[model samples]
Target chain A: MPRPNLAPPDAAPLREALRGIRFLLRRGGATVADTLTLDALPDPAAGLAKRMIREVEGLARSVDEAASAAAKGVLGGHDNPAEKLDEIVGHSSAAAEFGRAIYTALDAVLRRIGVDDAFISEMSARAVFAAWRQDHPHGQPQDWAADLTLRLLAARVIRGAVPAGSGSIGRVEPVAVFAVLLWLQSDRSESENEAVLEAAADIALARATEIAATIGSGDQGRIAALYRKYVDHV
Target chain B: MSKVRLTPDGLPPTNEPLRVAVRRLRWFKAAFLKHAEEMGAELGSRFEVDDTKLAAAFTRWLDAIELQRPADKSQRRAFFEFAAALMMRELTVDMPLKAVGEPSRAQTGSAAAFWPEGYCCTLFCLSVHAAATAQEFHADTTIDPAIDDLRHWWSFKENTIRDASFSAGFLQMLLGSQPNWVMPDVFRAKPRG
Candidate 1:
């Protein structure tokens, strides 16, 4: 795979992202599932789902901020005009709506947990990917992480492990994940990063397996316990 | 050709595509199971759904299709496309789509024509962006462009782009571009022998 032609003007943000990722790497356990007990997962899961909704809203705002900051930097908004213009336009309406679907699923999970929010705002995006990578001891061959997440979510829904509303997202089987991974692996520009993603996908699968096992035991009575344990602070 | 729509567990015509889908999905299941076996990952006996079971799943859907039961058009399409793409994707795994160029249907302003590009471009953009995001950790690595290479576009008919690799790339790119995006590391492709 080829690399991105250009680099972000400031490495600070990227560096900060790395530090946050490291922190997540050292932390063990599926934090989301840990936050709620089995019986209470629906409610809290719904809350976390809602948090994703809010997260998307917040993200839109952040994109605006990043645009503004980039505009103010060296170019005074004149740097790669075409690209800058693209950024200014920001995320599309369709994309925002898709975010809603993702949030809806999260919301369903929250409902089962019996809460309105999990408040994992401090959780960095990089960290999530890192933890995913750590989860895979074997090399990840393709984009299996997303597939694993999708599979677990879908299976949970199908089995009635998650709230009823959660089933709408549907099943994202391993084949789907593999196809995308195969596509990415095909790109010359990104060939180097293939191993990294493969690792992430592998870990994602392993983690999903763990989560499924936990849930398979029929509501480990853990989600509710976590809710009572942490809801007060939030 | 009469458009015979299918239900989840409908009977499928012993035709090219449906048979292909079942055969390919079975292969996928086997491959995944093999991976599980190698890792000693415990594809638990209970969790294990063998080729026989998977074939049963496909057969059930094919049977439903033949019965003319109400079926999910979207899901049926998804199942068909998944099988198609997996076959093509695997066939050309090591080959760059750019090296191959656009497929015939893509040349005639067909929907599938843009699929290769749409899929490859979106995936390329996301992969590069994601890799760039992770550049600090793993230095001196090139990402895969097969997902975005334009060559694969030539393989499909005009109406297949949506079913092409485009949707996958678009979704992942959307995920990557989000402000509060929780980047899934799976977007990164691992090196294979």
Candidate 2:
């Protein structure tokens, strides 16, 4: 039987929620956590904050549900969801753009919720590693591309820099992230190439984060050059 | 009756070196030929068996198997039989299906001849070879002789043996084998009682 197209439906709700959260973050004069605590306040702003918080949480849940459904479709072989996803997002499979989209959306929500970028990056890296360890208890760092891509994504998140092609940090399929994580966790031996790649990812992420911070996120040429420096070295 | 005492796992009661057991299993050639004929008959125009290449592939496969410690004493006989049946099916059935594109309904229907065990064994072997070859490619390590031979045979048949779903399934199976394996060593030899 011809497989059904399993592309996720329109994400208007998610987009709307992200916009609402971003607006609240900029204008509310309160951190995301502060907004959540508005019930304790007797001021008029408390009522508005309460309503906005509910809307933002509802939208975030909707995005999570959509991402989970897309992930299931990819795993179930309903279709080449990755290809459909790539078409929707317009990026290469290796770029892991689908995962970027999900991450980007979640990051937006988290940022508005008073979560710092460092914590987000650390958690994301740990989560990827945990998933990798679960799938491949003995797997070694075998695939260089997967390892490099993961480190790149992690670093981008740490710096709060947008992904190259996408205007946002971008979300990705968890399975794709998991696949890369498995490769990263595989072969923990400090072989020369493995050592070099590991170092390269670390050095690259740090340097990229620094460059993004100093020059601002809009310096695409410098950002590209910074990434290329590591890519070339590795 | 044969002097080789049979065990519960359908293997000889006493352990023998793989070479000795393989030498003793004189039926290997005959069994292989028999299965080859059956599979060829089933595949009809889509099948072609290259005896020289098939023998080479079998020897390479056997070499890899022999390196591993057997799980059961009776495993030698069972493994030899299993390998022969697997090679025969690959040479005739699966290879042809891959080569001629997806099988026709008539061809799919004919697969009733394959028992579930036989199908699993064939898939397991193919998955092992595929995984080994892919690892070799990534690591730039010398390819296994069996995988190299299989790749040559695949090329000869104009078949692309690397299917994504097949590789993913193989990875899942490989994960199941865990730290105990360097390759997808699914079939273990039975230990002697």
Best by lDDT: 2
Query: At residue B174, what lDDT does model 1 achieve?
Result: 41
lDDT of each: 0.31, 0.34
lDDT, candidate 1, residue B189? 29
lDDT by residue (tens digit), candidate 2, A88-120: 223333233334433443343333223333112
The CAPRI class of candidate 1 is incorrect
- Tell me, by TM-score, which candidate is best: 2
Which RMSD does model 1 reach against the true structure? Answer: 24.4
Candidate 2 docking: what grade? incorrect
lDDT of 1: 0.31
Question: How large is the interface RMSD of each prediction?
Answer: 17.4, 24.1
lDDT tens digits, residue span B103-134, model 1: 54333443224443333323322332233333
